[model samples]
Target: MRYQIGPDEPVDVAVVSAVSAAEECAPEALPQLTEAVNPDALNEIFAPKDEGPTRRSGTVSFDYSNSRVTIERNEYLTVEPLDVIPTP
Candidate 1:
Protein backbone atom coordinates (compact mmCIF):
# COMPACT_ATOMS: atom_id res chain seq x y z
CA MET A 1 0.00 0.00 0.00
CA ARG A 2 1.14 3.49 -0.86
CA TYR A 3 0.28 6.61 1.14
CA GLN A 4 1.09 10.22 0.45
CA ILE A 5 1.98 12.60 3.19
CA GLY A 6 -0.27 15.56 3.66
CA PRO A 7 1.08 19.10 3.68
CA ASP A 8 3.11 19.74 6.83
CA GLU A 9 2.62 16.12 7.94
CA PRO A 10 5.63 14.66 9.68
CA VAL A 11 7.22 11.62 8.13
CA ASP A 12 6.91 9.71 11.37
CA VAL A 13 3.17 10.22 11.42
CA ALA A 14 2.93 9.06 7.86
CA VAL A 15 4.88 5.96 8.71
CA VAL A 16 2.56 5.02 11.54
CA SER A 17 -0.44 5.65 9.34
CA ALA A 18 0.91 3.37 6.65
CA VAL A 19 1.70 0.62 9.08
CA SER A 20 -1.72 0.77 10.67
CA ALA A 21 -3.41 0.55 7.30
CA ALA A 22 -1.34 -2.43 6.22
CA GLU A 23 -1.96 -4.28 9.45
CA GLU A 24 -5.67 -3.42 9.49
CA CYS A 25 -5.43 -2.05 12.98
CA ALA A 26 -5.56 1.25 14.76
CA PRO A 27 -2.30 3.14 15.03
CA GLU A 28 -2.40 2.91 18.81
CA ALA A 29 -2.79 -0.86 18.66
CA LEU A 30 0.23 -1.32 16.42
CA PRO A 31 3.71 -1.99 17.66
CA GLN A 32 6.03 0.92 18.24
CA LEU A 33 7.31 2.26 14.96
CA THR A 34 11.07 1.90 14.65
CA GLU A 35 13.39 3.31 12.06
CA ALA A 36 16.99 2.64 11.08
CA VAL A 37 17.45 6.38 10.59
CA ASN A 38 16.27 9.23 12.71
CA PRO A 39 12.96 10.35 11.25
CA ASP A 40 13.57 13.97 12.27
CA ALA A 41 16.92 13.90 10.53
CA LEU A 42 15.29 12.45 7.46
CA ASN A 43 12.76 15.28 7.37
CA GLU A 44 15.52 17.84 7.63
CA ILE A 45 17.63 16.16 4.96
CA PHE A 46 14.67 15.94 2.60
CA ALA A 47 13.40 19.43 3.34
CA PRO A 48 13.37 21.89 0.51
CA LYS A 49 16.73 23.61 0.34
CA ASP A 50 16.85 27.33 -0.17
CA GLU A 51 20.03 27.14 -2.17
CA GLY A 52 20.69 24.85 -5.13
CA PRO A 53 18.04 22.58 -6.62
CA THR A 54 15.67 20.75 -4.35
CA ARG A 55 16.34 17.06 -4.06
CA ARG A 56 14.21 15.48 -6.74
CA SER A 57 15.21 11.91 -6.13
CA GLY A 58 15.96 9.72 -3.15
CA THR A 59 14.58 6.74 -1.25
CA VAL A 60 14.85 5.32 2.24
CA SER A 61 13.78 1.83 3.27
CA PHE A 62 13.66 0.13 6.64
CA ASP A 63 12.21 -2.95 8.26
CA TYR A 64 9.51 -2.39 10.84
CA SER A 65 7.80 -5.34 12.41
CA ASN A 66 6.92 -7.71 9.54
CA SER A 67 6.86 -4.99 6.94
CA ARG A 68 9.43 -3.16 4.86
CA VAL A 69 8.58 0.51 4.66
CA THR A 70 9.93 2.81 2.00
CA ILE A 71 9.67 6.59 1.74
CA GLU A 72 10.46 8.14 -1.59
CA ARG A 73 11.28 11.66 -2.68
CA ASN A 74 7.96 11.96 -4.44
CA GLU A 75 6.30 11.95 -1.01
CA TYR A 76 5.08 8.42 -1.46
CA LEU A 77 5.24 5.96 1.41
CA THR A 78 4.92 2.25 0.72
CA VAL A 79 4.51 -0.63 3.14
CA GLU A 80 4.88 -4.25 2.09
CA PRO A 81 5.33 -7.55 3.81
CA LEU A 82 8.85 -8.87 4.08
CA ASP A 83 9.76 -12.18 2.50
CA VAL A 84 9.55 -15.06 4.94
CA ILE A 85 12.53 -17.39 5.07
CA PRO A 86 11.98 -21.06 5.84
CA THR A 87 14.08 -22.52 8.59
CA PRO A 88 16.08 -25.62 7.88
Candidate 2:
Protein backbone atom coordinates (compact mmCIF):
# COMPACT_ATOMS: atom_id res chain seq x y z
CA MET A 1 0.00 0.00 0.00
CA ARG A 2 1.19 3.47 -0.84
CA TYR A 3 0.27 6.85 0.62
CA GLN A 4 1.30 10.33 -0.36
CA ILE A 5 2.06 12.87 2.30
CA GLY A 6 0.57 16.25 1.70
CA PRO A 7 2.91 19.22 1.62
CA ASP A 8 1.73 20.16 5.09
CA GLU A 9 0.95 16.75 6.45
CA PRO A 10 2.66 15.64 9.60
CA VAL A 11 4.96 12.71 8.98
CA ASP A 12 3.94 10.98 12.17
CA VAL A 13 0.28 11.28 11.40
CA ALA A 14 0.79 10.06 7.87
CA VAL A 15 2.77 7.09 9.10
CA VAL A 16 0.12 6.06 11.59
CA SER A 17 -2.70 6.49 9.12
CA ALA A 18 -0.89 4.51 6.43
CA VAL A 19 0.07 1.72 8.77
CA SER A 20 -3.44 1.55 10.14
CA ALA A 21 -4.92 1.29 6.67
CA ALA A 22 -2.43 -1.34 5.59
CA GLU A 23 -3.01 -3.40 8.71
CA GLU A 24 -6.77 -2.90 8.56
CA CYS A 25 -6.79 -1.73 12.12
CA ALA A 26 -7.82 1.43 13.90
CA PRO A 27 -5.10 3.98 14.48
CA GLU A 28 -5.79 3.81 18.20
CA ALA A 29 -5.18 0.08 18.17
CA LEU A 30 -1.73 0.31 16.68
CA PRO A 31 1.24 0.86 18.92
CA GLN A 32 2.54 4.41 19.20
CA LEU A 33 4.83 5.38 16.31
CA THR A 34 7.25 6.95 18.75
CA GLU A 35 8.01 3.43 19.90
CA ALA A 36 9.68 2.90 16.55
CA VAL A 37 10.75 6.40 15.53
CA ASN A 38 10.95 9.82 17.05
CA PRO A 39 8.06 11.79 15.66
CA ASP A 40 9.65 15.16 16.31
CA ALA A 41 12.93 14.24 14.68
CA LEU A 42 11.15 12.60 11.80
CA ASN A 43 9.23 15.80 11.21
CA GLU A 44 12.29 17.92 11.58
CA ILE A 45 14.24 15.92 9.02
CA PHE A 46 11.65 16.64 6.37
CA ALA A 47 10.69 20.13 7.41
CA PRO A 48 12.04 23.12 5.54
CA LYS A 49 14.64 25.13 7.39
CA ASP A 50 14.13 28.88 7.75
CA GLU A 51 12.42 29.17 4.38
CA GLY A 52 15.16 27.08 2.81
CA PRO A 53 14.69 24.56 0.05
CA THR A 54 12.44 21.60 0.67
CA ARG A 55 13.98 18.30 1.55
CA ARG A 56 15.09 16.60 -1.62
CA SER A 57 16.12 13.13 -0.48
CA GLY A 58 16.01 10.69 2.38
CA THR A 59 14.37 7.39 3.23
CA VAL A 60 13.20 5.98 6.49
CA SER A 61 12.11 2.35 6.94
CA PHE A 62 10.80 0.58 9.97
CA ASP A 63 8.48 -2.20 11.01
CA TYR A 64 5.13 -0.99 12.24
CA SER A 65 1.84 -2.74 12.88
CA ASN A 66 2.87 -5.93 11.10
CA SER A 67 4.01 -4.04 8.03
CA ARG A 68 7.27 -2.69 6.72
CA VAL A 69 6.75 1.05 6.31
CA THR A 70 8.94 3.31 4.20
CA ILE A 71 9.02 7.05 3.70
CA GLU A 72 10.91 8.57 0.79
CA ARG A 73 11.66 12.16 -0.07
CA ASN A 74 9.29 12.94 2.80
CA GLU A 75 6.50 12.75 0.29
CA TYR A 76 6.00 9.18 -0.83
CA LEU A 77 5.27 6.45 1.67
CA THR A 78 4.59 2.74 1.33
CA VAL A 79 3.69 -0.15 3.59
CA GLU A 80 4.21 -3.85 2.83
CA PRO A 81 3.10 -6.86 4.76
CA LEU A 82 5.86 -8.65 6.59
CA ASP A 83 4.36 -12.10 6.21
CA VAL A 84 4.06 -12.18 2.45
CA ILE A 85 5.54 -15.21 0.78
CA PRO A 86 7.27 -14.51 -2.48
CA THR A 87 6.45 -16.85 -5.34
CA PRO A 88 8.77 -17.28 -8.26
- Candidate closest to the true structure, highest lDDT: 2
lDDT of 1 by residue, 10-39 (tens): 888888888889878888886676534576
Q: Which tens-of-lDDT digit does each residue in 1-88 have in candidate 2?
A: 9999998899989999999998898999999887888999988887877876766899998887688888999888999998883536
Worst 10-residue lDDT window, candidate 2: 79-88
- Overall local distance difference test of candidate 1: 0.78
Q: Give the Cα lDDT of each candidate.
A: 0.78, 0.88
Per-prediction tally of clashes: 0, 0
lDDT of 2: 0.88
CA lDDT, candidate 1, residue 28: 88
